[model samples]
Target chain A: MLGGARSGKSRYAQARAEAIAGRHTLVATAEARDAEMRDRIARHRADRDQRWRTVEAPRDLAAAIDAANGADAVALVDCLTIWISNLMLAEADIDAATRDLCEAIQRFEGQLILVANEVGLGIVPDNALARRFRDEAGRANQAVAAAAQEVQMIFAGLPQRLK
Target chain B: MLGGARSGKSRYAQARAEAIAGRHTLVATAEARDAEMRDRIARHRADRDQRWRTVEAPRDLAAAIDAANGADAVALVDCLTIWISNLMLAEADIDAATRDLCEAIQRFEGQLILVANEVGLGIVPDNALARRFRDEAGRANQAVAAAAQEVQMIFAGLPQRLK
Candidate 1:
């Protein structure tokens, strides 16, 4: 699932994931570096039920997905952009990380719902870092969309299927 | 049509507009405020054939659309986000303007193609102005999509129909 902020992507992805009859694993990418972030993370968590086993994967997401792999597994990565941001902050090789992610996504037997923000539609950022981040985010989304069996873009709670 | 920066939205919209055998009107929202913008506008202009008549509508978009309305008119609004930005900079009432634009779109007889940036998908902006811009842009987009007969979100040059 791909969408802008407040586009209800996470809500849609969660609903989709919950509909599947399987073990629910939420591999979250958010890390509470600040109070606002902590509150936001808490609110998201509140929407999830007890059925979901949370796995904090601010980085090392591929490994987390690998760990959750099963015939009846339903893994919802509550986003890729935050994970990408984390990787960037850690100075990790983004290309290699994205590659690993695609590979993991391909090989995983679970029904995966990968949520990502479509951040490249705005005017070019004033700062170089912001621009670079958008570029990486857009590139990663394209790569993932190519790998996935289905893709949907959420706009104000509406699902528009792309694949 | 709505899409991100360099996501092939303009190219796709141009192709769609060119396909319509009508009096082509390119209602452009961009103004050359700086050298970079001037160059960008020039490059975009070079893509059009001699058939298209240009109308500059940095803020007066509704009037431009009204002027271009005809049974055989093909009007392509190159963008709406930049126009919104111009309105915001001018301290114009965004909601009222959006309402007027939507009304004009509904009343238009032309084969209309609208371009807008989906700017709210990324991490929230650090500044208040950007956040407001994204909010206004998103609201305007939803309004436009509702008014439009068809809506599309372009990604990597591929068009995905939304409505």
Candidate 2:
């Protein structure tokens, strides 16, 4: 799943995951840092209710996914963009992270829904840092989408099936 | 702005945009391809209220931005990732789209909050297409981040000021 802000990508991915398996595991890539964000997290948590087990992993997503894959749980990676940003600031190698994630996806046995942002359709950025981020994000989406059985683009809260 | 699924990135960005400017314009990058997605879009529309003008633009973001720019309206680009994907699939030269977006950004004089995904932190994709998308996304993020005056990362619905 991928799309613009508030494009319903997350909700769509979550529904798909829930439909696939009873034991749903949501591997979150976000870390709460403020009061506003806390509220948002709470809302999301509430929306999922008790049916989904949420794991907060700002880093080390591969390990987290592997741990969740032990059971017959359907793993849903809700957003890879944030994970990438976290890794960049943490000084982790982007290439290494991508490689690890792909490997984990290949090894996992249960159903998976990997959600991400498709961010490459805009203008070229002015500075080197911005350009670098854009390039990495583009690569990440491609990798995940390729691995995914179905690729979807959500716009205005609508999902367009891509692959 | 960027974050994981249900990470509050969109709300944070929306609030920021509302607080900073008067007349608001939302440049959407989703294509609305499913029933679930339609509901998602409706939710977002309700969230935004009737104060802002919405533009349905799945491609040619530079032109959309150009049309949205004016003295009374501030452009809020809710995302860049989907736009990139659309370009990658539709346009022959993705780099040209990047260049056009950047150029438009440079010329725009109003308040613009451009959201994008950071995609380089995950494991390297196994296939060539995935690898290429990751690389392109990274480049795009870096470019936009460098160009923008401020950059923020959202995690677990919490935002970290990174600029």
Candidate 3:
């Protein structure tokens, strides 16, 4: 699933995972490194109950997915852009990390849904890092959407399939 | 029409304006205050022929439209958010300006197509000015969309009618 902020992509992903018969796990890539982000994470946690087994994976996303998935498990990676940011902040290789993550996604046997933001729909960022991040995010979305059997974009809280 | 940066909203608007049988008037709200912006305006000028009579309305959009509209005219307002930004920079009353613009739109005699960016579908800006601008843009879009006879959203270079 792909959407802009507050477009209900996370909610839609959670709902889809819950509909499937399996152990539901939410692989959160957001790091509460700032006060505002911590509040956002807290709100997200308050929205879901113990029904979701949550894993914090600001990095090492593939490993988290590998560990969380099982025959009867359905894991949802809550977002990809944050993970990209984490990788950039950590000086990790973006292409290599994206490759590893995609491989893990392809290798995983359990049902999975990935959430990413559609960030390319706005103005060109005025700074270099923002522009690079936007480009990287667009590339990541294309790679994931191509590999996945299904792709959807959320607009105004409504879901529209793109693939 | 509403879309992201480089999403062809301007091109689409220009094309729509060209297709209509009337005196084509482009009410551009952009101010070429910078070199990059000047280049952009130049490129836009090159794209259209002498058929388009351009009006540069960085602010006072209502007056621009009221003056541009004619019995044999079709006016295309290239965007609203930039006008909003201009209004903000000039310390213009946003609500009053919006009200006046809507009134002018309602009273226009020519065929009209308005373009605006879908700026609300992104992460909340961390700064107060950006946040306020986003809110104002959203309000402006809603007001314009409500008054218009038709509305459409563009994604991935495709158009979807919303009303």
RMSD of each: 6.1, 18.3, 6.6
Error of 2 at B10 (Å): 26
Give a tens-digit lDDT track for model 2, residues A1-163. Answer: 8875344567778887877755788999888887745775786778785788889878898898888885576988977987887888898998888888988887788887888876665456666666787788888888877777788765434455789
C-alpha RMSD over true interface residues, model 2: 12.6
Say which docking band candidate 1 falls in. Answer: incorrect
lDDT by residue for model 3 over B1-163, one digit each (tens)? 8777777888887887888899888999999999999999899889988988899999999999999878788999978989999999998999999999999989988788999887765544659788778767766776787678777778667888766
DockQ values for all predictions? 0.22, 0.03, 0.12
- Model 1 local distance difference test score: 0.90
TM-score, one value per model: 0.61, 0.50, 0.61
Q: Which candidate is the best by lDDT?
A: 1
Cα lDDT for residue B37, candidate 1: 94
Clash count, one per candidate = 2, 69, 0
In candidate 2, residue B10 scores what lDDT? Answer: 83
Q: Per-residue alpha-carbon lDDT of model 3 for A47-98, expressed as tens digits?
A: 8868898999998998998998688889999889898888888989888888
Q: What is the C-alpha lDDT of each candidate?
A: 0.90, 0.75, 0.84
What residue pairs are clashing in model 1? A4-B121, A121-B4
Better of 1 and 2 by lDDT: 1
- iRMS of each prediction: 3.3, 12.6, 4.5
Chain A TM value for model 2: 0.91
True-vs-predicted CA distance for residue B117, candidate 1, Å: 1.5
